[model samples]
Target: MKNLVLTFLLTVITVGSVAAQEINWVTLEEALELQKKEPKKIMIDMYTVWCGPCKMLDKNTFQNKEVAAYVNENFYAVKFNAEGNDVVSFQGKEFTNPSYDPAKASRRNSSHQLSRYFQVNAYPTIVYLDENADLIAPIKGYQTPTQIELYLKMFANNDYKTLTTQDAFNEYYLAFKPEFKG
Candidate 1:
């Protein structure tokens, strides 16, 4: 009976840990739809299956507890496959990867039109959009949770609006401290 109880408790703990690590990633359309009812900034993780750094960002940054909690609470997170065939309609236009091949889905296929629209020329770019679905910034590269925490907080608190010059951004970046452990 004690062994059975121990096993049950371990199972429960494992399930809870898994749930805590999972980020609530929504489709781009779903995020836009939700924005209509309740406004929130949108964060899109543009990645390709073939990119190693992209996978690292998923396993390290997105899975971080503090990053997951903050993003889920303050933004509508969207995971977009840059080379996928999914048709995305945004702002008044339709975007698709017309040349995307299913066989090449696991490899480097054609990029979606939306990626071109956002000018995302690299993998693992984190695109930030304002509450109205307007582009705020496209930060390219693999960022650790500690590295991304600055942008997340800056945008969430409307600090980016006041950063009109490079000097201002440098000042803010230098003065800011990160608290996220993961």
Candidate 2:
């Protein structure tokens, strides 16, 4: 009886942990739809299947409990395949991969039109959009949870609006303090 109770408690704990780690990911269209009802910023993880750094971002940063919680609460998170064949509608325009091949589904395929729209030249770019679905910024490369927290808070609090010049951003960076731990 004690062993049974212990197992049940451990199972419950594991389930809760998994739930916290999982981000509520939505498609670009779905995020736009959700925004129309309740306004929130959009965070798109633009990644290609063939990119190793992209996979690491998924396993390390996105899976972190603090990062996932903050993103799920403050933004509509999107996991967009930058090289996939999904058709995305953004700002009243349709975007797709005209050069996507089924044979290279798991390999390096052609860049999606939406990717070009964001000017994302590299893999694992985190694109943030404003509450009105306007472009905020694209943070390139693999970022740890602590590193990403800075931008996440900066945009969530609309700090980017005042940061027009490079000097302002540099000052902001110098004064900023990261709260998320690994």
Candidate 3:
């Protein structure tokens, strides 16, 4: 029947949409293992379920094929929920959300200690780390697809190590594209 065919089509579309939204994320431990085997930088997307900008970044920036491909190729990308209950061990320390309250979901429980360890002050914070698991500064707030591309290229090419100051980075960034507004 026509109704049956329409229902099937809608189901398929819903499934496809959900699949597209799903990110291929690895845990911190898995990323560390990969880093140990090969020298690749790490990009941690520190997000919370209730954050709007974080959802936008996932739907827009991270979903972009170019951004996803570059991240997959150059770094061990880990999507970490700030309020998650799982145990995260980093730098010989175990980080966990010890005060999680399922009943009061509105107030997203305390962020894991790892969130503080990385100094994430806002939602949708992206923490970039070097090959040795050293902090390369946490890029706070939401970033557009193009903006993320710039950082990915800068860190991927090891430009961050050479540029000591923001002014120097801006100079180099401008030289690359003088008309760039951001």
> Would you estimate the TM-scores of all the predictions?
0.92, 0.92, 0.82
The 0-to-1 C-alpha lDDT of every candidate, in the order given, reads: 0.94, 0.94, 0.84
Please give the ranking of all candidate structures by TM-score, highest first, separated by commas: 1, 2, 3
How many clashing pairs does model 1 include? 0
After superposing candidate 3 on the true structure, give the runs of residues whose Cα lies further than 4 Å from its correct spot: 1-23, 105-107, 177-182
Residue 167, model 2: Cα distance from true site in angstroms = 0.8
Better of 2 and 3 by lDDT: 2
Displacement of residue 86 (Cα, Å) in model 3 is: 1.5
TM-score of 1: 0.92
Per-residue lDDT for 147-181 in model 1, tens only? Answer: 99999999989999999999999999999999999
* lDDT against true structure, model 2: 0.94
Q: What is the C-alpha local distance difference test score of candidate 3? A: 0.84
Give me the displacement of residue 24 in model 3, in angstroms: 3.4
Pitting candidate 1 against candidate 3, the one with the higher TM-score is 1
